[model samples]
Target: MQRIDSVNVRPDVNGAGKPGFHDNADLSGQDATYLTPTWLNTVQEEICNLIEKNGYTLNVASRQQLYDIIATNDSVTALAEAMENRLVQLQAVLATKSALEQGISYVMSELGQHKTASNPHPQYLLASTFGVHIPMTAAIGRTEIKDENRVLGWNGQSSDWTANTGEITWGGSLSGSVEFTPYRAYGQFLLSGYISTATFFDVNVRVFNAEGIETSLIKVTEYGGSYASYGMNKVFEIPKGGKAVIEYRVDAGYSKRAQMTFSVYVDDRVKVFTPVGLTSVVDATDFTESTQNDVKSDYSSFPAFEWFYGDTNGQYFELSAISNMSDPVNKIPHYHRDKFTQLEKDLYIAVQAGKQTIESPSDYAVIDTQILRARTDAEGNVVVAVPLSMRSITTANNETLVYTFVYYLNEPDVTGALPVGLDGEHKIYVRL
Candidate 1:
């Protein structure tokens, strides 16, 4: 009538023949039931079916292969741990894929809008539009004196003088004097003269200033016996209200007579006006005239800005030297104010700022090409066709947004660990 515990049963014998079940009893025999063993086998089969349904091929029937895969763990623990590890890997892969998708979406949407979120500092755009100046071309006036004259100093006398309208003919025996029409204003004069026979003779031309002092002297000595013609050209600066007299003197030579003819030209053309904030002088006594009388000026002493002869219009002269002149002569205001529209100012500012933003040589090259493609007038003044803020929307906005995305994406996670595959050493497998 007492209940027997199953733990007290022996495996080898039947309960009716023995006080307890025999430990060596065969449960597979016809007299016994293998219910627990059957249930355990059924659970193992179910587990194998579940693994197969979940897209995994497991050789559960081959205990050796299963043991090889899960070498150091029990069968159930090994299988569960492997599945959990694989699931963790899958989650990491999915996270990375989602981040990429979101990043790409953000880039495409920002680019599609063709603009950024409202610029917090709209003043940068406004500053570009206000008070932009561009250079303009203005017609500069110029003049040259082509007037011709022939004046003889005297009819027959060498010392006494009278104006005669003929070439001055003098034997090497007699010297003569001739005068050019006095220049009314400060100007440059080009004098050209020729001597018929300069053989075995001493010929000299002296330029006397308004004060009757010899300012320039030119003398040519003849050494050959053959009669040859000599020509010379000289440039001289005549002061305002100044008169110049050229005295020709020649010693009597073997040649019977020598003919001399001279001509003068005055150039009053203004090549370029002195720029603003500078001083200039015309026919100043401070500089001397060298034989190389081309229209070159050295204004190193009176520096700020200077207009030399033959200067191009609208040329920018970099400041080099400072002026020490306590009182500069002929100082004049010469700079003209340049004006620009709002759009033009924006374009100019964009180009200027873009150039300054270049951080490398490659960037500089790209920016230079872009600037060249920008519109410009014949005078090299920038022209604006559209608002500069709208130009190169993709390049400009992408530069900013992509930079931010990459910077933040590269940052470490909350645990101070990099993404599973981005630790610089791990390999990642992406599904799509």
Candidate 2:
């Protein structure tokens, strides 16, 4: 597969001035020199026919052709409108195909060990591997400054801190704590919940380990003189053989009710190796045939751009003017051209981020003409970073050129056969 750098059609305009498209003809005219209504209808019908012939699917090349038409004749009101609508529908199909391909690639890359004939669905295996959900009780256990009127529960109701018949004269503070045990070993743990408060007070929430050591999870100190609500999603590592303790505090001088509901989800203990021990380690010197084949196949299938639209061919009928569109001399001012250019870069980044990664420091390969670097951290987490220079696009810009490029890649088979050795000598544990 080949990678694309810039889809800029104009060579004369340098830097940010290039509109990335060419003006073939005055689309505002109805003459034969411009795109006629008859030509536009014919092209639309032909594209529709091609899509129907291909089982209502447009290949990467066909989609690019349509995008070329849309880009070149976008100034033609009626023709551009029709093609734009069709392009949107086609893009939807392409997006779905892209998602399916990415999903299959992920299963093939990440859960290759779990692929089996007996359980052909890798997703189910993946779910069983890391879908352990041990629901913790969200009830508030104890409080520091307790009051009889203060209420706390996990029944989706407001936990109130009210004065005892105007005893404190709208000034008081309350705190509570809860403790729960984790179900598994070390993994990513997510704590998500929301808190609603009234009478304009400050709320602080924290999580502590089994040793009474506080882990700073959530803290809100700013107070507005009205009701306020907050939502939190915090991810933390759960140490081996340890539990979590949740603590919350509310301070206010007026009548305030703070309602909070939270839950914890711990990642399941799914190991890359069956028996996670020293014996499970393989000798670095020994390379099997299957291992060599796997490495070769991965290198052979590295994702790349299969096709790209550099110019408008099918949409612009006048061959001479259309050919001259890429010339550096004939330049047209397009205000939104930079915005479209940025969008192209963004799309490339998104695709590369989803699919590509650096294996080592020396492997400096470019994808879609941009260099991406990946490094493993101290905790063995791969962090992929792409260098970006920000350029702002605003509606205030008057001269802008818009060019469209449609990228299409072959979708992988979602219902394909699973890999061998999926049902190896390991017990499949399902979460209840």
Candidate 2: residue 235 Cα off by (Å): 2.0
**Candidate 2, overall lDDT?**
0.32
* Best prediction by lDDT: 1
Candidate 1 overall Cα lDDT vs. reference?
0.32
Query: Could you report the Cα RMSD, in angstroms, for every candidate shown?
Result: 49.4, 33.4
Worst 10 residues of 1 by lDDT: 400-409
Candidate 1 lDDT over residue span 168-217, tens digit each? 12112334555542312234555555565543334444555544446776
Clashes of each: 11, 8
Per-residue lDDT, model 2, residue 75, is: 31
lDDT of 2 at 363: 31
